[model samples]
Target: MSWRIGDYLDQSDLDVIVVGIDCNEGLKRLDEYGPWKSNEMSDVFSAERQSIGGEGKEYVEFIVHELKSMIDEMYRTLPGETSMAGSSMGGLISTYAACVHPHAFKRVASISSAYWFNQKEIEELIKESDLSNIERFYMDIGTKENTESMTILHT
Candidate 1:
């Protein structure tokens, strides 16, 4: 579980800081999927399939905490200006991070998010969490795919 920060830093000069969290389940799937799977930019099946069990939330929270600490120590960024974005399980985790720690990230962009993770646990979190401070949120998915899981997320 290493994070790539350069992808999100092409257009702007905001002193980008990328935080990577190691979800053991995700790593396990990646191992099974082979290193070549990492080359696919839009694949989320492996991560979504691994989003069951109790450790998911813990991993998300840990990432949020680490992100906060990184922002505080390295960039001096306030929560209102920071943006967090990811795809697939990373998207789900990014959404959870912003929702759970609203004061730490104000902008969230989730592409092909596994919103169905943990049987709507992410939805419940969004419904229950306080989000008065969040300023921006972006969610999108590929429309050509007809998979049921993607359908649910599209809706």
Candidate 2:
């Protein structure tokens, strides 16, 4: 997934360290396993649960523990200053990370999230999760996107 975070850095003088990780690796196909999916999904679009490899949780742990440790060794970083953002399936996983790892992902932007993969589960997760740690949360849907998914998101 491509994010325009660089645009923000260019437009503003805010110092940012944007680390991009490749979620599509390990010889697995994109449909087979991806960081964006945290649960099994059997929809008409595809029959694979991208979370079969546990990329979502694994990625969160990697970012919060391993990657953060490495970054801290080099630079002084504040607690709860990390942010995550993505689009489509990537957006889904970003949202998951923010909810599941609030202490790490303080800011989140999920654009056109594919919540339909497990709409009920994600909605329940959002409802059950404590978002007090989040300093900012942003979500958006285009007018030309899936109507049914948009309706569900609205609900």
Query: Which of the numbered candidates is closest to the native, going by highest lDDT?
Result: 2
Q: For this target, which candidate reaches the highest TM-score against the unseen true structure?
A: 2
lDDT of each structure?
0.61, 0.69
What lDDT would candidate 2 get against the real structure?
A: 0.69
**TM-scores for the candidates:** 0.62, 0.72
- Clash totals, every prediction: 0, 0
Q: How many residue pairs of model 2 clash at the backbone?
A: 0
RMSD of each: 8.0, 5.1
Model 1 C-alpha lDDT versus the unseen true structure: 0.61
lDDT of 2 by residue, 12-113 (tens): 978777777766643243342244443343232235433533456676677778988898678776655888887776677788888888888889989888
In candidate 1, which residue pairs clash?
none
| Poorest 10 consecutive residues by lDDT, candidate 1 | 32-41
